[model samples]
Target: MLLNLKNIYKNYGKEPLIVPVLKDISLEVIQGDYVAIMGPSGSGKTTLMNIIGCLDRASTGTYLFEDEDISEMNDDALSDLRLNKIGFVFQNFNLLSSETAQENVALPLIYAGIHKEERNHRADVALSKVGLQDRTTFKPSQLSGGQKQRVAIARALINHPRILLADEPTGALDQASGKQVMELFKALNDEGVTIIMITHDASVASHAKKILHIIDGEIIENKQGGAA
Candidate 1:
């Protein structure tokens, strides 16, 4: 398994006023699995994503990624795991407005201590893969919404992460742009990328191989997707 979460529980606050968010959440994902988590507002999906992405630890229970216990790891180790094993795409394209597409794509490599020449080369290759080769020199302000998201996707994949975690990735785009982004996701999944996407849109969830419905901080259903 690529990821395993058993009896996970997350809570905020302390004492008698502690608020429970996720309760007994058990989930597993194998390599190359395309899973979509569906939920409405205040459903605790974001909190779940943060734990899965190694950004936060569950208040109780165990999480294992590639057989390594996440709860046992220190902050630095967790940061390394996030940098090397997972890529994140947010609802808003979090591109640096001051940087060009290539520069933004190369940011992760810089943290990895990669040389400038190789970073530029790899960034170009990643941008080309996302059909943004021509936009490499363009700033975020110069690109359309779809193009900016594409740039964000390219940046996410630049490190060749084992899993891509997208939280409402198409939420900010128009219908046509969203369609294009879904197509890109399909292509990436076909190439054996393990994708875990959080979306409220049934249309978007249907694109995954499996749909996991999360309600009131619990996974209530697991259904097959039409695109499987």
Candidate 2:
């Protein structure tokens, strides 16, 4: 299994506003699984994604990644895990405004201590994979919403992560642009990248092979072979 969450729980605080976000949540995701998580607002979908992505720790229970328990790992360890193993695509294009697309895509490789020439080469290759090789010199402001998202996707792919976690990846694009992004995701999944996306739109979720419906901090239903 690439991921395993067992009886996970998350609480905000200790008082009246102490809301329980996830209660006894258990899930397993193996390699090559394209999974989508769907829920209404405030239904704990984001919380679960945070936990699964190693961005937040569960208040209780175990989180195992590749069969190794990561629940007790320190901040540095978690950072390393995120750097070397996971890639993230956000709802908002989180690309640096001042950086060129190629530079932004090379940032993670830089942090990994790769040589400058090698870093640029890898970033260029990743951009080519996402069909953004020609836009490498453009900044975020120079690109359309879909193009910006493609840049972000190239950035995510630079490190060759085992899994890609996308949160509302198509939220900022128009219908056509959103379709393009979804198609890119489908192509990536077909090439064996494990993808986990979070979206409220059923149409967006339909791109995945599996859907997990979350509500009231629990998984209400799991459907295989696409969205219901």
**Compared with the true structure, what per-residue lDDT tens digits does model 2 show for residues 33-69?**
9999998899898899898999999999999999889
> Candidate 2, overall lDDT?
0.90
Clashing pairs in 1: none
Runs of candidate 2 exceeding 4 Å displacement: none
Q: Name the 10 consecutive residues with the lowest summed lDDT in model 1.
A: 219-228
TM-score of each: 0.98, 0.96
Task: List candidate 1 segments past 4 Å from native.
Answer: none
- Positional deviation of residue 126's Cα in model 1 after best superposition, in angstroms: 0.4
Tens-place lDDT digits, model 1, residues 9-128: 999999989999999999999999999999889999999999999999999999999999998899999999999999999999999999999999999999999999999999999999
Report how far off residue 46 is in candidate 2 (Å): 1.1
